[model samples]
Target chain A: MVLLFTAGCRAKVSESPIGPSVQLHAPLGLPPVPIPPDNPPTEATIALGKRLFYDIRLSKDNTLACATCHDPEHDFSDPHPISLGVGGAKGIRNAPTLINVAYQSSQFWDGRATSLEIQAASPIADPLEMNQTHKVSVSKLAKDPVYRKMFTDAFGSKDVTLGRVERSLASFERTILSGDSAFDRFQYGGQPTALTPAQARGLALFINPIKGNCAACHTITPQYALFTDGKFHNIGIGVNDDGTLKDAGRYHETTVKSDTGAFKTPTLRNIANTAPYMHDGSLQTLEQVVSFYAGQGNSNPYIDREIKTIHLDGQERSDLVEFLKSLTGKLPPNLEEEKSHP
Target chain B: MTRFYSRLWLCLPFALVITGCKSSPPPPTAAPAKPAVSYFKVDPATAGSVSGKITFSGRPPARKVIDMSEDPACVAAHKGKAMEESIIVGNKSGLENVFVYIKSGLEGKNFETPTATVVINQGGCQFHPHIIGVQVDQPVEITNSDPVTHNIHPMAEINREWNHSQGPGDPPMHRKFVKQEIMIPVKCNIHSWMHAYIGVLNHPYFTVSKEDGSFTIANLPPGTYTLATWQEKLGTQEQQVTVAPGGQAVINFTYKGRS
Candidate 1:
């Protein structure tokens, strides 16, 4: 895993004579972009990655792409409760938003993958997902002249290796950052009038230890806020009627008993745009999600200690939801504009 | 003694080279140069020990029952009787798992980092010996002996934090903390309830209290030291203790329970 302290360092694309090195500037309230030392974001590589992200050839039967589930228009998250892959294969968990994912310590709800490069390779081979072998995916990309040239431009060689593919995809995903929202203006921008009365009250409860206590896990430092602790917690979601976990979320990967209903904490940035929250996408709206927390989560043995019973009247609940909405921020420029080719 | 003297001779050239590189005098506030010896050696005749009992005065908190039903292997391993180890109180209210160490007074002392590795095993879905101490730069070997995968995550503040997944039959992971951190909390994100604490010190004068609540730091050079004991839930307590040459210093600490 990438060290947490290095995640905030402004990483520049390595000097390359092939293309202009893109200097990724973090927007307000977000920390500097952490570019992998080996996979720096040259314009050629980002362009190649963007083209690969939108290419259906990466999937079997030429139907699915990374963008199919992580839709740029929907805060880079799927609208469905759980994502549907090629051949309508149903996924077990919700497709989490990729916004600000460059800051995450681990990937996937289970956090099985340590790096984004590792994460980008899993779905293409998973039977329920893209259902394509890495070898075949590389072969398909290699078959195209346009892809061959792009690969050469990105990696200084025409060889389309799986490692290069993973790196390029990760480099592109790192640029999908979002920050500088109304909440940022009010909290960090020194503008007290940025938020309405309800949003201001909601922010109060969000940070109040005894009230919302959301800040305990959705951390907000004095300088910036990622809205996530990057730790796993069993918030009592997906519990069966018999008190057994419907899905042994994180435990499937770790085999640790307490991890039985746990999942990685999703960032609350642009949460207003990503509907159907939680790992399972059980609650449809922010109100239901807040109510679930207020109800102290479904009682289970491994539930997080931070999940405490709290009182939030209708007004307070609405204010909290409004405060969450204020978190929706500006996306990176040209993110929504689809590039047809590299 | 001969080997120690030979190692000091081997380090003299490198020490001189380091000093020769400096063009200006060090600031007055700079620390004194470390001794050229490879390691500090305590005189066997003058060496003393600090031993103590960590006791709890009030009623101990009830241990919470752990539900391991999700993993049948874990359930079978514990036979449905696994309990939380947050506050393990034994006979005479002796607190188990309290980390006792020489928190200060060992400054400027360079003890040789032990080559022997500290082993922590994952079995029965829990970390065995939930609290432990290791010298800085000493290797900590973590092994998974269960029929499942285990992820070891050390949330160290001073040391670099890392997490790795270890599956059944996988080779043990050897890691070391480069800096001194009083206590680093470790957790398995996969197993949210599994918790452990690691106390990393530069010196070798640290140990965890056993189930009987007794701890000992042996082979210490006689001196006054700031001794500290840390409990996971009860927090930390410090005291001043002076050990006479060749004498054992006995101390005791008490923690009150919540009313």
Candidate 2:
């Protein structure tokens, strides 16, 4: 009910009570979409951002676009947890799906960076990723008069800055939100036949604080349960390549001793699409992730203090994993728009 | 005689049981206890503040162009808005975002916190105001006003630190200074060059500069204080000044150039 900094468009922000409620296309069960005061989601910004997102020419080699890794068809992920970037270099972490990313707190597995605009730019420069510098990208886009016009219209001035690029990409990303999964009907709406008794029981065990402990991190809010706490935790990830703990995750950046082994808690919605879980993409299946937590985290020194040894029987563990599998939602809206890869 | 003898035996047995119970008591009650309180206070201390402004002295500093990275999907850390420092229009002032704070002293000061923590937004991919002067023990809300995501990474040594990425549409990032330090360096890792400075003081005697490079700290409680200034490119300079109650005392320091 809290409309924070929005102009009512009869969509929630703009429409005054006097105006007819613009046939609200907002998916059932979601907090009002938060839009910044300066850059409210316009038909204009979204169009510009979408154009840039699909444009392969945005890359240094003109071989890939944002959809190259986040193919909308395969549940917004490429199915390969760790993806190949420009020059066919493998990435360090899995290609996380864009479903419900609007609800996330931090972006990367290590959480080294924050904000989508900032997060969008890292890959373009990382040698192992897009491998394109800002200058190279702007110059490449500048070659096309159409893009130049689009950039000018979306950002007022035609002076292409990194800020404009990041803002555009981030705007496109916000449109890729996820909801309306089958499981939601089975739970929230009284569609009793939606889920079998077994899945229902599975949901019960999944929510149990003592046995599952999944809700602590993978939250299950009553409405629009994005299934994430949007916080960071160590979760006892494996040691680093140097035989020392891996990039101290958040610790490497902040040097606050407590963050020594922690990584951002990933969203569980459509987590099944993004395989090879964790920061390093080590775990292969939902079963593996479930079993890892069942073992109360790898019993490592840097493991989070909250990760305690759990005692889930075989049936309970199987049901909990099933509950997670049910979270696989529908493919993103723009999947068809995303060009198919071979 | 029989009744008396029976009562005497029962009394002896009960006395023996009582004696045993008194000799071996529960160990759980052995330790001394303290009252429960939310936070531990260091000492009886009054609230304080720090204020100062940035100075180019003669001319404004030059501005640097911002760059974006080219990493792939999930290649970047966070995808959100830019801070206030990242996208401000012009800064002839060469080096902006000079943070100043007291490095030591002023841990656990007793001060009334404001109803709502103040928000230092990162709009237009830059830090709003470029520089902030805050009293120690005050809370700061680092907000991302831009459509893109931003991470508020504060490099603090004397107090509890934070490094959080603020995504679009997400709640604001709230933080408090439990300890007092002269200055803290705040940065956005996404924008390698995007930086801002915050000056934290134990007393209300700090000010950051407007575009004109004018800083001020008002409402002093009649005391001698060490006032300081910091520049992102230039080092720190401090001077001593005395202010009468309810009166303003102006303090200034000059630096030759970036050290």
Runs of candidate 2 exceeding 4 Å displacement: A1-26, A157-159, A240-244, A338-342, B1-259
TM-scores (chain A) of the candidates: 0.93, 0.84
List model 1 lDDT by residue over A185-215, tens digit each.
Answer: 9989999999999999999999999999999
What does candidate 2's lDDT look like per residue over A1-342, in tens digits?
222211122133211111111121335444555554444555545666687777777677878788888877656666665788887888766677776665566787666666777787777777787888876776677677776677656755444556667777776777776555556777666676666666676778777777677778777777767777777788765543122465477787778877777788877776666776777666666665665566454333566766764555445656766777666666445434634356
Candidate 2 lDDT over residue span B1-259, tens digit each? 1222133223433443444455544355334485221221212133223344444544433344343432221123235533334222224432334443333232443333222344577765567556666655556667776544444567778865545444444466556776666567877644445567666655433444444344444333345666555665566676776655444555444444433
Query: Cα miss at A70, model 2 (Å)?
Result: 2.2
TM-score of chain B of 2: 0.59
On the 0 to 100 scale, the lDDT of residue B220 in model 2 is: 33
lDDT, candidate 1, residue A197? 97
* Predicted complex 2: DockQ: 0.01
Check candidate 1 and list the clashing pairs: A259-B191
